[model samples]
Target: MRFSRILELGCILAGLFSGAAARPQDELVTENSSACKNPPKRVEWRQLSTTQRKQYLDAVLCLTKKNATSGITGAVNRFDDHQAVHSSQTPSIHWVGHFILWHRYFVATYEKALRTECGYTGGQPYWDWSLDAQPANLSSTKAYSTAIFDPTTGFGGNGDYMQPSVEQNPLNITGNTGGGCVKTGPFIPSAFTVNYPTPDCLRRDFIPWIINSFADPKLVANVLAQKDYTSFARAIENVPSFDQPNIHGSGHFGIGGVLGTIGSAAESPGDPLFYLHHANLDRILWTWQQKDLQTRLNQVGGPITPFDYSGKNVTLDFQINMGRLAGNATLKNLLNTTGGTLCYTY
Candidate 1:
């Protein structure tokens, strides 16, 4: 048998035996890797000191204040450049083979911009939203009430309350609590603006049901239990329904308003929290990969065409394009978070 076939089979077997174990530091990714001499450690949003949080927010704002460096003709700021890349290639990237790997690269590039361009000193931070969606708080998830929405210290609170008026792709947003523009928080009209499909307020409609029912810890644990790389990817990307709630999609709907509305599901990068949100998903993918790193670090499978399971299977050599932000990279280079092109760990 060819090495690729042997490798693919190994990944399937490892995942079958690897249950949804809690994320661990079983083997340090960059500890002995020569390619990454000093990898940055990604932490949870709440782990950052007040100063670190302030720095991250400031770096994001700095991108907003600068002019675009890419050829995205519609973009107005450095930050908009990233979304322009996403907005154009939105459909091709999601519900496809490259979904998780592509987003991991995209978020890492954004993080690099935050550090290299905006002078952010620390690595990227992820928001473990499940902590706020535990069973105890299942009835009324601690989503909107947490410090993550602190007007002074965190991303601002819910937009002015507006009844739900949306139903998109996989999930329904009828239970949204805020639909108007965000009036508080760092990205409010006074402080931030998004320029894609036209300039608009950064809106958020914290849906407790999304948290209580869809994005709760149980969904995450379930996704982690999948028996293979392909199965895990399919599970994570499942559209939410009464029987199944997508952990990945739930994060977006949980912050419903404009992030959910713009581009169906593509232009989420318009919201500043998009990076933090994606970082957590990457963390989940990374945790899943860590459980069987030997097999998983090289294991990637799914269709090349978005939502077309019958299409050609994407291989490790498939090229993922990111426009001008980070240019093109192969699926193999992005497989491992540490020694490959990426250099960070959660």
Candidate 2:
């Protein structure tokens, strides 16, 4: 067999037998040793030139017009698949070790859908909240007030709060300050409607307090600095030591209004911000993976399953389900975005 083929086989075997017994650390393949591979340049949202950003948005808009692949009856358009997939798998993927890998897969495939289906030429852009998490400028961060939120040039600011309180579980959380349809953005109902017909807007209640307190740059750095995967994942998701919400959750709250759909966790994908937020998360993971390439790439942490939902114990070999949007996927295949079926970098 070719060396690349051999390495691929090794990854599969390692994932399969990982839980049964310990394997030599040096035995696992690090990355594909392909001689010629094109690296994908995934830039930050802010770094994108006006044309690039518009192209990216145009592609996203294009996707909203495509038919859904999730097979859910009544579901329409590719964008709907995002909400459908996330809703069905919410129980198994969130609040677990698989959080990172599962989301990585979700965002990657979504990006792929954009390129293949909608002819998006650029890689997905990420929202690095840390840059905007500065104490002195929390209230004025460009993340919410700048071009990214421009009604014509950006996704638009908060929702218009046209409807009553939306009921999000765990807490009957009210929609953000606006709580209505997005009155100022490109995704307004007249221009583009959601999969399901709803009177509510794409709401967002920008909570500077949450961004300052939970999504702090220092806190995010500390979360990334953890030497082990479990600690890292927990800090981003649970942050047991602090009374504040998890860093990941903080981003949702920060952009939430009618965008509160993002706060829903399961329905967050309903909002376009979900991909940008997750791309940022994926960038963090990619950055961490680059530190000690071999070990970090193969390192799988936390339970294979969600702690609150299914009781199944996760093994390193666990296969992540992507619903009808993707074929069989595994952590091994997802570990290195530049390897295997993945070939992009941030």
Q: Which parts of model 2 are misplaced by more than 4 Å? A: 1-36, 134-143, 161-176, 196-200, 239-242, 257-259, 308-313
Any idea how many clashes model 1 has? 1
Q: lDDT tens digits, residues 238-292, model 1?
A: 8424355677765676776323332134347887778887899899999998888
How does residue 222 of candidate 2 score in lDDT? 75
What overall lDDT, based on C-alpha atoms, would model 2 receive against the true structure? 0.66
| Per-prediction backbone clash count | 1, 18
TM-score of each: 0.85, 0.82
Error of 2 at 323 (Å): 1.4
lDDT of each: 0.72, 0.66
Ten contiguous residues minimizing lDDT sum, candidate 2: 1-10
Error of 2 at 259 (Å): 7.1
